[model samples]
Target: MPSQIHTTEAGFELTEDQNCMSELVKLCTDRPELVLFSRPRDYYWEDVSAGEFLAEVYALAKGLVANGVEPGDRVALLSNTRYEWQLVDFAIWAAGAVTVPIYPSSSPHQIEWILEDSGATFAFVEDAHNFADLRAFLLREDGTPPLSGSASRLRRVAVFNEGGIDEVTREGEGVEQSLIDARVAAITHADIASIVYTSGTTGRPKGVALSHGNWMYQTRALVTNPIGAVARPGKRVVTFLPLAHVLQRAVAVALTIHGATQAHWADTSTIALELQRAKPHVVLGVPRVFEKVRNAAYNKAADGSGVGKRVFLEAERAAIAYSKALDKEEGPSFALRMAHRVYDRLVYRKLRDAVGGVAQYGITGGSAMSPELSHFFRGLGLPVYEGYGLTETAAAACVNHKGGQRIGTVGRPVNSYEVRTNDNGEIEFRGPGVFGFYWNNPEATAEAKHDGWFNTGDLGEVDSDGYVRITGRKKDLIVTAGGKNVSPGPLEEIIRQDPLISNALVVGDGKPFVGLLVTLDADELSRWKEARGIPASTSLEELAHNADLRAEVQDTVNLANATVSHAEAIKKFRILNRDLSEQDDEMTPTLKVKRNVVFRRFADDIEALYSR
Candidate 1:
């Protein structure tokens, strides 16, 4: 029988002390000299003291009020992660208005829907490109502006990279600072702070309404929990993930609340250098970032000669064994310890330097991380703590802390939430962190919540120790014609672990047998071909049809098949000429595959797989 309804509540109480603005005030007053934010200048990072940041926030808040933005109005931010994005978010809150964040990569149509749905009055865009996209969306084909009733409420647009701050400051020149302060004081915890739209994979995105109390409670719960150690006063963090995502937004707030210094890197291409320069104590990322690092390490090791390659393989074995021994509470054996010591100096040290020598911990979410990758990192002295939650849960419901961490499981619930599996095996949670409703969508809100518990739509189970292990998405579970229930997540996760494979989708629903659709890691593929003396000019499509490449992928498939029964094994597969991407609408912003979109786009290829 399934286990009894497992429940784990936070061992702490809610902080009834202050709202977000109140906390910011306290931080600025108490630690005025401390650096709160750092933005990149030409070749150096320029610091903004806590006091300075608060002043800027107040100035912008006054600017919004001066421009006729009323309390409870919506202000949208369409941009990549940057210093201005953080400032604008706080300013929106300080102005007693709700923030609506749109992904920079969102299509014009998506931009139109979100702006209209949230009734945004003002918007801040990142660059010229974003400004054009928003402008086109708000105007008609004949080049005329949207008329009265059919138009967006947006009356002003500020371009962040082009004198936007100066314009706002200029607009607020005549407005009294006392006006902005009064608005901030009048705000209550019950007021909505933001409307974060879910990355729509199956249908239109729904705006999740998160109140100030929801974020405040989440920040307090995270800081007081064991994971709070990562947020120590002198610690630093580098944030590059999309701020539109609730996870990054929550982290940004939590860091500010904890008084940790934040370094913003808008250009993700320079993440390596940024890490080295910032030397953050804690790093947060999605599984894709970690996976690429791991794959790159392996590819580099494989490029060596006989002795070097053998040493690298032996070192990996030692690391994995050492990690396993640690998990069992038994120290590494003498031989293994010696091997680890030798390898730590030779192999692991280089890997550590790549992410900056100061990083001691990493937090991964947005998707399930492979256990192999988790263990491998732990072996390198960088313990990656996996967490689980959705946009509706304010980014994190449960997370593994430093003191109580288990590999392959998204640890116990934080101090304010309770997690349990329902009768249908879906994870359900209830807490202050859970959002109250979906903006303007009563039906979705009703379907998503019951009694007081919010259904997470993820299939998972809780161990006796209360660690939750997500099995698969409840909606993505495949039921074959033979009546076998299979989850494609695990199989795909295992396949993607191979250095050459970028992504894999297992499909067998209502079919005779299982099959796969695979995409290659373009970089790794190039390196792979170069190592074998193949010409660099060889096209990816030609390589996909190569006999040798297919056989190598087959080996990965065979390994994945071993994880399941005969009925669930991938019987055949087709290598796609191009990888699924966000631009193609085949993947979500969070890098989740859009299964329905892929199915439609590759209908012919899928049919060809089963034709025989």
Candidate 2:
């Protein structure tokens, strides 16, 4: 109904797989040994081509179809990030099946619920790590043997190593080489491609159904507007975010579609060196990674003993002060510019090397980013921009166009979306990027879509220029007993500005005051101790209660409080020792804080603050 789009062109004319993935096939087939990806199988780089990857997966798909996989059958792929994980996903769609991507760290219970709910006919799992867990689920939970010779729809699971021999061995249908190497070429836009489950932070996991048309819209939007314009091909990249999250999946898939051959690292720890070695033209990172780089730069520039550290700190002060003056439309004084030039060569340039020397731009998403982090990086000579999207939007609906961005907010809506705010203060979107209903949950599906409007569940207000400032999630707002409402996201972003704090969740609903539960940036805190003459402790918990550390957090809280209204100010907080992990279900696979779990676990602690 929006005038911005021509409804007659609602869908593209090309067939699903062809239009969506033809470019990817071209790149990989053209260069078979281009090191398209790096993972646990370092030795397999010799054969890491899109042609090689897809052929084996297509062969497996054909085998599955022969072994009784019908159209619309939902299949699950359980694994950590690897080229094969993506292969299985594409193969499922190529076979006219829907994919259900399960996280690598899923416990037996979560996996069981997904398996039963999705009615998965087959599964593709990573080697031993995936097998041990699945094996455990079958044995202890069911306490039954494999139903030999049974006509069960849940047939078998194929395993692929880090990158070698993407093959299949089946009971009824033995998979062969040539059959697996043929191109898998049948799919329709209307066909369901995948059902990515929502994090069960509020309730049980709800599978959001997405069609090929939905992902295609997503792929086309992000690929053309911002990412395509920004990252040139043959440039190296470092991917640290979990591929289980749709953001990484969509971005990586977009790269493949756009002819950007990339190099991936095994894990986050190895990412820095990989970037340095690869000299990546574009760096895709989350706020946490950027925060780490900033802190490390700050530490590196610090001189050990008394006078040296003071002089270095003075230079940083002068550099930042000069930058701030320029930000206000005032030309930098000649003396200040000279000071910045000196500091740039001596201090900031060394910091840039810490994050791969020549990174043209860094792309960020998944969580709200600190404006401070953005400014710090730009000051250090890397222009890191932000993006906004969700799993239901096939990942990206908006992004900052190259050479077209304002530092703070996630750039305007990308991929040609129709956006309007409903009276309920919720942002409802309608576009090709928007997905279908939640799989099989009609109640949820109906609730999420009103006419064609997909409720984003986030709150935002538009700027004069149409830029959107995301305040917070509708459900994440905390309204005090006095009727004063506060959005935790902006405040949380401010608190996370601290170099030694990784994440913070602000809580205060139906209570007199607001407080925070924080996860510290451990490595930074340890370094801070050594540099400041403070003693080191065994656990972060001990450090959290340290007088100096407590005061530092209090100062950060105080600074953050000044930015919000009196009603929204955080009066108190407690520092948490461990980062929220899968074991606690305190975070989603994408590492987003599961608010419901945190609130429930510390209900007593949250309530006690109000008594004071």
Model 2: lowest-lDDT 10 consecutive positions? 1-10
Q: What clash pairs does model 1 have?
A: 10-415
User: TM-score of the candidate numbered 2?
Assistant: 0.87
Q: For residues 1-612, write the lDDT of model 2, one tens digit per residue.
A: 322221212334444555354455565677655555544443544325556665555566776776567778988888777666666676666566788888886767777778767877778787877866555334223534353432224555666654322335242145443443332344556667788877645778888788877777777776665667533456556665777778887777777656565665546767777677767767777777787776666665553456545655666576556645656676678887887788788777776687778778788888877876776666656767787777777886666656557667777677557666677766667876688788778898898888888888888755555566677899888998888898998888888877778788898888788888887887777777887777775577677677888899999899889999888899888877577776677877666788988878877767666767
How does each model score on lDDT? 0.85, 0.70
lDDT (Cα, 0-100) at 70 in candidate 2: 74
How many clashing residue pairs appear in each of the predictions shown? 1, 2
| Residue range with the least summed lDDT across 10 consecutive positions in model 1 | 1-10
TM-score of each: 0.96, 0.87
Residue 376 miss distance in model 2 (angstroms): 1.6
Instruction: Give candidate 2's error at residue 544 in angstroms.
Output: 5.1
> Clash number for model 2?
2
Error of 1 at 420 (Å): 1.0
CA deviation > 4 Å runs, candidate 2: 1-18, 26-35, 38-47, 136-153, 162-185, 230-232, 303-339, 531-535, 538-546
Tens digit of per-residue lDDT, candidate 1, span 15-89: 444677778988988988888888878887799889999989988888888888999999999999989999999
